[model samples]
Target: MSAADTKAVGPPVPVPPDPQPTGKSSSDDAPRVQKRKRKKGELLPYFLILPAIVAIAAVYLYPLSKTVIMSFQDMGRRELWSGEPAPWVGFEQFTNILGDPEFWWVTFRTIVFMAICVTLTMGIGLLVALLMRKLSTWVRLVLTVALIAAWSMPLMVAASIFRFMADSDYGLINTLIAKVVGEDWLGHNWYLNPVQGFGIITLLVVWGAIPFVVVTLYAALTQVPQELEEAAALDGATAYGIYKFVTWPVIKPVFTMVATLSVIWDFNVFGQIWLLRGNKPEPEYETLGLYSYSKAFESTSFSQGSAIALITVLLLSGVAVYYLRQLMKTGEVE
Candidate 1:
């Protein structure tokens, strides 16, 4: 080879290395991209529910906050009408409510009323639910229709119906009782005595509440495993024993939930009593709801009413917490 040619090829020219990709590989970035998409997916549900949250805050939270504010102040008819601020009295309203003898009496009466109504509603509903399990398809269908019909009836209509049926004159109840017992029940003023008046109210409350209880319990009962029940029976367990051990454990959660809800509902009963009493429930017929209404609207003691209502809310919250704990223990919720 010529010297010049050998000189030209003295060394192979150094070439720059090919550039590597910057940052990360597509595989390495896959998770980050997926993470971004997952985050977006998570946020979608909250966005969907945002409107509901806003609506609920406006409808319920605002009034509740307003009530709490009013409870701290000595708000009355003047302040309510004038839209001016009321004098702040702190806990004086609550103190007054606690000290009042009539308030304690009303509390006692309300507790008793709730106890009686809850007891009857649960007991009768359980019995009805059990009976339904034994009924033929046709009869069960009939009962289901009746219960739904009763449940669907508006509170106002139900109250009116009950009122007419319990009228002092020309009442179907009085006529039936008189015919059966051969006693003069006609023109009997049920409201003359607080006990009798409360009895009627209790009946109305239970009648309205039972259908819901029955339906809920029935649904719970249906979920009980037939295999377990059969196994219990095969082991020579008695009817009551099987129920106590198998059925009860299964239905207990639902029963407790229903009972808790019933307590909340019964504690707040007002419309039926108000309607039955012609919009002026007697002091003897007064419950927590009615008492609050009486204080706020009738007496124009808005702060005191607000305090009473706040107390009721606290009590109900305690009840709700207890129910939630029971559900947790039963594995009904996490």
Candidate 2:
């Protein structure tokens, strides 16, 4: 071939060296690498919550376990002071408490009291919330302030004030009643009758609880669609009917939650009764908490007290589970 016809190869174009390769395909390794990273990310959340979990276990779980253990033992002042293991009675404490007529009566009283307080709290709270919705800006502000004040008052202080108001001598309420009814109300003991005494306590509880319920319900109410309410009204629905059809459904979840909470709190009422009855609540005033306290401290039956408290916890747990189920049904909880 002629030199002019020869093509220039340029040192054979230096063929690129074969790309280096690992034993594994890159695509196959990708997923495994991603999985390792994902696992590391997942662990971060649990690590972040570890402190909270530890605190809860120490504060709540520890005491709860101790109470459960004590319930099965014959722990008394002796064992409590000496820090010695009490004799294990193995459900005898539970058996005795469950079999006792007084225990049953106390439980019954507690349930009744809880029902009354919850009903009144829910009813009054809802009414107040509705009223707040209708109120002008200034009136609602005033009402909110009043509610906050009531809610901020300490429980002991509220109980003491109620007790003083119901005092046999020189009580403001008695003086007002005497003047209004022209009857000899001064020096009249309200605690002489159990029914009257409990009624007063119920009032005190409802008063303190209404602020929270009203605030929560009112917040929920504000989120309700006014257009729906107006449409219902235009369809010839009464106010109550409009509320039932449009308003209630929107606030029902909140209402249910608050009512359940009220049941829990009222069922555990101790301070109010204790203070109202001069710190020595009579047999007639014995609810589950008072009964438990009396059994533990007054009679030095710590095991029986623990058993009663455990029973109360079980009862409250049932209420809590029901509330959780309701929330789940409403898609408010997972």
Candidate 3:
């Protein structure tokens, strides 16, 4: 064949230019493989958290179980002195508590107190957080520190101070009231009146609890993307409309959490009532917390007190679970 024809109709043979080694390491590949290995090794974090889980179970669950068991037993000094096995009395304590008129009254009072404290705390906290959001950083920090200082003070100390301040004879409040409303105010015994006493306790509780709600709500408020609020503003939404639509929806979960926690804390309150009212059942303001303590310590019905305590725990747990489910729902939506 001619050279041109041979070139145009060449044989279909492939060209072998380079030979590469198989199963050989490359410099760039080593770091990538090592990074993958490092990631696989990082599963130890979950194991490290196991200790905290065990500690919580030991501290809270163990005592809760013991309390539940003791609620069924006739546990008291008499049982201890006799050195005899206390017989199991299933549901008797619960029934006695349920049947008692005083229990219902105390429970209602507790509900009212919880409602008042939770509402006031959440409302005031949200208001303060909104106001603080507009302030300078230094002012916000100072106010936050002051609120936390109030919250960090011991509950007993706060209750004692409130009690002293409300005393008709020597209380600073009474002195001020006397000056404003004349000397007749000095004769009024604030502690002796159930309404007045409960009102004071409610005020103290609200004051102490506002800090937690405020801090939590403030943090949640800050997390609300500023862009969203700006967009709403551009859309000609009113100030209240922006809050209701953009700001509130973002912080609703935190609000729910704070409210639930406030309810739980208020329902379980013991210090203020005990410090103010002693063991006597105030006809208008007796709370289940005080009633339970009185039942167990004063009346020596330990089983009944345990039953009441368990009921309180169950109610609070239900509330916590409900709100947690709501938080989870919010997360899913986001």
Query: lDDT score, residue 29, model 3?
Result: 91
TM-score attained by model 2: 0.85
lDDT at 283, model 3? 54
lDDT of 2 by residue, 1-334 (tens): 6555556423355689998985889889999999999999989989999999999898999879988998999999999999998999998999999999999899999999999999999999999999999999999999999999999999889988998898889788899999988778878898899999999999999999999999999999998999998888889999999988899988988898888889889999998888888899899999999998899999998989989999999989999998888778767432
Off by over 4 Å in 1: 1-50, 327-334
In candidate 1 the C-alpha lDDT for residue 56 amounts to 93
1-334, model 3: which lDDT tens digit per residue? 8999999999889999887867657987999999998987887777889999899998999878977987888778697578777779998888887898878888888888889888888889999999999999999999999989998999778878887888878888889988998998885788777778888888888888889889989999999999999999999999999999999988988788778778778888877777766546565665777777777778787777788888888878888898789778877877
TM-score of 3: 0.82
Give residue 35's error in model 2 in angstroms. Answer: 9.5
- Scored against the true structure, residue 34 in model 3 reaches a CA lDDT of 97
Enumerate residue pairs that collide in model 1. none
Worst 10 residues of 1 by lDDT: 325-334
Clashing pairs in 3: none
Better of 1 and 2 by TM-score: 1
